[model samples]
Target: MTTAVPEDALVLAGGGHSHALVLRRWAMHPERRPRRPVILVNRHSTALYSGMVPGLIAGIYQRRDAAIDLRRLAARAGVALVIAEITGVDSTGKRLELSQRPPLRFGLLSLDVGAETRPSGGMPIKPLEPALAFLEAEDLEKPAGDAAPFCVVGSGLAAVEVVLALRHRWPERSLRLQAFPKRLEARVLQVLKRHRIELQPADAPLPGPSLHCTGSRAPSWLQATGLPLDQNGRLLTDHHLQVEGETLIFASGDCAVIRSDPRPASGVWAVRSARPLAANLEARCRGGSTRPWRPQRQALQLLGIPGSAPQALALKGHWRLGPFRWLWWWKQRIDRRFMAGFQQLQTMDSIDPDASMACRGCAAKLAASPLTAALAESGLRSAAQQPEDAAELLPAGTAGSSWLQSVDGFPALLSDPWRNARLTALHACSDLWASGAMVTSAQAVITVPALSSPLQSELLRQTLAGLQSALEPQGAALIGGHTLEARHPTPAPASLGMQVTLCVNGQVRRKHTGTGWSKRGLRHGDRLLLSRPLGTGVLFAAAMQGAADAEDLDRAERMMGSSQHPLLEELLREETEQEELHACTDITGFGLLGHLGEMLDDDCRLQLDAVKIPSLNGALELLEAGHCSSLAPANRSAWRWLDAPAGKAGPRIHLNLEGLPIGGSRHRALLELLVDPQTCGPLLIGCSETLAMRLESLHSWHRIGCVL
Candidate 1:
């Protein structure tokens, strides 16, 4: 692992099992960090070993336990980890095409990205992909609203495991299954034959000049590169394990199919390949000749559960080992140890140079979808008539009394309290605006961590300034507010917030509490139009972690700032019109989708134009890339109505919206002209088409997504 850091590149494009050991060796040796060699791993994270696939699928092991943490691993190995996906290599030019980073120029390269199963879906199944089915399975936290069937087209151990995992994940469902050129393995065929399972006899189908999955053969591109591949998709290589035609390019493990020393696509080959692969890389770096890779005649191969316990059919020679619990235990221990390297990384205060972060979630924040969904669900509700019959008919109480109030909160994730106060203030007045009231006064509700009194006061001053600035537009004054010192609260402070929230209560000059003006009284079928776009929930979460670009952050800030006042004035005008525009009142906390479901009327259903709905600058990209606000889960949990079948509306956005939004272009753009709840938030603006258009036409309409 130690040597002069060589600028001459040796690009290792995977973090497969063998490469991991190589990386670990590098990590422990500091020479590897500087000039050792450049290791280009495509996956930013780690890939799990195949042995733990069954346990992971069976829910016995957490995903962290099954997968390796490549980043942490590479870091420990003192190697630069380039987070990218490799498309292909121009070996002739010695350049590699990657999804991220510039096409790398390398002096020597070894690709063990591993083979994928038969291709499926728009996402290409990697050559000999292990999780082809499980990864593609629609174990959609919720049913896909319909029984959306997915396919797996392989007849190998990997394929069987995937199918069983899928079956287990969706216990009560009618799912279709399809396998081409079915019967595989001598043992499997014998069992199926005994159990009356059908199969097309080998060569009974037909012979063809062309290549197909019907025969075990490598695809054209891989074969054309001139790496050894049997007629099957397996990589063809020599006893030395050098991929054919390319001397420097060593292909081993599941990717290879040895000609002279034929071996099944099993761990034995990869494990055997590791010794030489490591030696080869080391020798190449040390300016020495590569060693020959010898494949074992037979080694252990374990089958994952199709319908079994902690059991496996082990392969060694012609003799098969018992499906013993002990074997499973041994396999479990090895896999667990590997995975533990990842999962247990942070606990080791003193970092090992070679261990990569094991948990993707260790540094990850909560998703945002559910957060918006929750707020949106509660933002609007019908109210029942609380009779205006005066409890005090006499003028003893000096006319109707009003209690000016404000409740302001910001997504606490933003570390600065002063900044949070500003955002929180903007959010608080939203309730006053939506309710068609003018703010009379506001106050600070202070909470602080254990700190010096001066620090507390300074914090209080900054917060009040932000609050005052935020509330001024609503014509509210910060009269007074309360504060407390606590470690945490039920609704955490702005530091952890996805979106800022605050409330300012304005007095109704013409108090109408007697009227059933509250949201609980509203009917269903009211078309749900948004005053703001649907990405603040995501944007807030993204901003909290500072994951967003400067433009995105600016857009988010502007969106929150602009959303206030504009909607408030609009609501105030509608209130004066004496025509009750809103049958209910609710702020958008859950999301446009979640809140829309709350007020559904029998004949009135929500119809939306996908493109018509506004989005924050990076919102669309965030949702697509699977970033969501932390609050998303709660929203989804509270509004199970989204689970119902309502045609396309059933699954609002068909994208991976369940997670927190990590703002990208759309979310940033949406934030530029959004009525997101963070700042003043937008009034729900429940009105007729004419009023909706009028609201949409206003310059301020851009602050909130246009009502129309």
Candidate 2:
């Protein structure tokens, strides 16, 4: 979320080339950016650079070389990155309707969503992601000799590049191109013949897997917006890239056509329009006049040749050049230089030294000291006093059954609303799982961003769906809930402005013996087991700074979204009945050390093998680089409770770090991770050493320490 004062929100509806370049420009020149919340909505976290897509397909470039990391770009530009499919636009309402989330309201909007290619009988290649997936799948499913002939349909640069790429990928496979002879230049046809690709009429029947690059047309969803479109179904815009007769709306890239000075839909024009489009959008946001953008009538196009040696054809208007090796080298240089701008981000310094970037997720929670102080001041029972993950409901239910309830939530840690809600649900249910309770029912208090009526309804609908998805598997029902709007709304890619708190009810059965596990009984020599790795706090904190790797973030999210039910079931299996769980609690906002302190008895001490502690990938590296959750400092205060002097206010829970060299990088990282707050973190279980060994063999749990 942005700290900028509430103002008109500017929404860039797509991660097209123009928008990506615009974001890069804004990152470089912050002063030129409008002082408003800027949001970029797209279907994926990365955008394929169209210019290098041909190279990528031909194996001249890797996927990473051709794809732009929108997450990092948005972070650098201070823009909210929303990864969601856009369904339609409410032009009159100035809102973008999304597929799974609410409509995004905007004071100013820009459409660089690119164009679509309708395929008559083959795969459409307009949307690069799906096409790439298709190629990869085909390659895996069909071996070289068994594969059918490859075909490309179209009479444009995209089709030509694809056909050549196919030849490079499978040299022995027969390749065919279906294109109108009138649309192709004589020289181009000659090159196709030289490459041994059969050229047929545009209406020729396709064989095997056909790749359709049949030019560009506006996405069908745009027609529902009631925007003025040219004959080809592209949004008609004036010279300044603004929709005709609409001040707040703007359009560029293949999805739009300039009415007065029309240019063919191409990546060249998209790249060229970036500067003007960005300037115009900023001007509109500032309530200033927009400048007209006059693009060159002809653009230089470099066509790659599929061969052992690198070669390319340069075309501009009526002028053409040979498939020279120098041209390919030049093209590679240009593409790399263009991509480098995004790779090397400018270092950002805080404008206010007093303010620091606070970590999101559970790390955003109130510190332990103030929270305990407040609870004491309000005459409420603290976690230390209760020593249970959930509160027990009064009176027994049918038979000897009792009830347990817990509520847990936090600000959005992820940009995807559905996934965020899923993570939140799993976190809320963790309390019940810790107490060996089966979740029965839950009620949610959902606070969404202030938006139009339709948007609010949509947001709530998606949120509830996410909640139901998580609870359904556990035999839990969503009985009732309340909804409200945030007092101050900020632009999010999806539901960052939304916060969900679930009051979960669970049932715990007693077999006429005793209650379920609580955080009070830790026998001496009992082993401490951690269900999962630590460092979600540090990873997410690094993500906000664009310092986290994409793979690491994806892994972390997968871990967070995984339910703890399976682990709970394994622990409660009859085979493990001989070994009892003595104490249990889920590590949450408070770091592991902070939460573990509650489970300690006055005479108990913990001897931990620092080397045995598992950490999420890159978490330690990030911590070593001075990145840590904002709550780490406050959570460190828990150390004072450990080994406190005699007569001091102490539970006397001393912590001894084993196998750790003091003042070393690894040691420092481990210490910070111990205090790093976690959202949907692991469960700390106290059990016998034999039980820990048995469980570790059965699951991924690690034995971190032993009670003394």
Candidate 3:
């Protein structure tokens, strides 16, 4: 069964190993997961596994091999993933100050952000991303004659592994380890000498591009939280992993210092603590007793050496093993096993499989024929023919020029309400922009699912905030609208998500002149250009089925988030002459081909190069797997027009599309892409070739075909 409006929020900060494990554990036991809404806030969508950092540096593994897609994991675990940086905490208010957004309120907070290394005034590799970039940019395989001397500062295991990886990449370089008077085991010292690495003094300057993997400290912001801290400035926690004095706060991994069982900062402890941390969080949320986490006193350490031959050393307590090939193999097995958990993720359907994924925005609209017939039957079309996206209602009045208005809305497609609001507002405003109207005002009509008063209020605030943010920048004020609670007498077996609509009003710049752009302005022999790619519907549908890649979903979200207002402005700036700009319309629920059919007049037939259309990154792959949008069939029904006889037609018009080069898998794939419904899709423009070139230099667009 689904949950009602949650009374509390459990916020997990950071995408460290411990938190990644916690999410994985919750995915395994969904029933045991907390009822409170879970939120995971992080700086990026993916987390780097520290165990594979050395492998990455040594060129043994690629970036993807060591990274986990936290966004996908959160979706699987039923958690909301917020990409933001946590700057500090408000202990009294139970809020977290974020870098890019408003402070987030939470009922319980957990920090597993890991630790930061002390700045050495040189290059530090504690955070991992910057260090990885540096390694990738450097020519590590250069000849010893062209290479400078290399040095590492610190006596920790990270420093040892990094230095060895560097040496393995360039054996001839003058490699050195700088340990500040700290003595190492005899075996480790011998191993360093065997690799011809010189030990340098701590006070000495770094020789070249150095990696400082020194001892780590807690984030400086933690000190300001007023929580008890260790001498090393880490948050102090009790046996139960709760902050010493703060009952609602929890900490783990390198950032937390267990007072009773003091342990060093290590990824091993973080991996081992995932279960207890997850269990304690579940128990705390349930108002039950929590168990204590007991860390191992001595953990096994493995170190890799440089060379074509696979060699590694294992150390535990005072015992040391030989630098054997089998040890390296064993470590590889462990690392791959850990990574496989993320790489081979399977999407388990919690919702009914038969329940179709809902299309949002224009795609959610009823099919054109049925809607048109209804309007015709009611004599609405006979009054003035079907109105365009925006209608010029008035001539020049004392107040302003011709007035244009259009209304658009659809059920929510995204879990993020703020983004949904923004997209919906943008979709509505596209009609005004197409008419070359200056946006004046906007009003919203929102329908929210049944929920508690406070939760419903929060949803409305978030939705309107996004709408206002998108509209105000275009100089349009949100006058106001209406809201309703959509509660059915008998609830459906499935969840009823929220929906929104925006009605926008605008004024044409010129008075009593037909200089504005519209769908009917197409000229024969003009080139067709698209402002964005297609295939969002297919990608989203694949995502609902757990078949889409995480990276693909991320790319789709970015494409949807982009506003077409800027593109509209750029096109207007380039088209000095009104004749140079032909027909223009935003691709909404209908696929590109479907929208293109609307722009065609009797004299013009579209001749498209199937290969020229652009699409989302992994769109075609999903299509090959038989993934398609819910509205695809309706859109593809346009094939009737394309197949119709040229001279025989009644009131219904035909969309003549011919000369498509479809000989291979790619051509067939593009055909399928042409009919995929788009949300905030693209602006299909028919313009002169000269204008297309000018717009091409300013934007990323495609010239798919032309009007014949």
**What is the Å distance of residue 415 in model 3 from its true position?**
2.5
Please report the TM-score between candidate 1 and the true structure: 0.45
Residue pairs of candidate 3 with colliding backbone atoms: 362-589, 363-589
TM-score of each: 0.45, 0.76, 0.87
lDDT (C-alpha, whole model) for all candidates: 0.49, 0.80, 0.76
Candidate 1, residues 287-379, lDDT tens digits: the string is: 666666565566766654433454555765566775567776776777677666545433123343232121111012233344345556786
Evaluated against the true structure, the overall lDDT of model 3 is: 0.76
Cα RMSDs, all models? 18.2, 6.4, 4.5
TM-score for candidate 3, residues paired by index: 0.87
Which has the better TM-score: candidate 1, or candidate 2? Answer: 2
Ten consecutive residues with minimal summed lDDT in candidate 2? 347-356
lDDT of 1: 0.49
**What lDDT does candidate 3 reach at residue 343?**
68
Residue 64, model 1, lDDT: 50
Query: Per-residue lDDT tens digits of candidate 3, residues 1-708?
Result: 011223546889998888999988777667877875677888777888888878888878877788898876776777777767789999888887777446666778999987888887667887788777776666644677677777888887678878888877666778899985466777777878888889898888777878788889888788888889897778889878888888788899899879989988888988998889998888888777789878899888788775788788898877889688999988888889999987666544454456546555556778766776888898788422424678666663534446888998888766556667887888888888877777789988888767656556656776887788788878889998999888752112111256888999987653335556778777767888988888888887787667776667778877787777777667666776554677788787777776777776666667766666788899998887788878887777765545646675422332223564545555556667878888878888888888888888998888887776
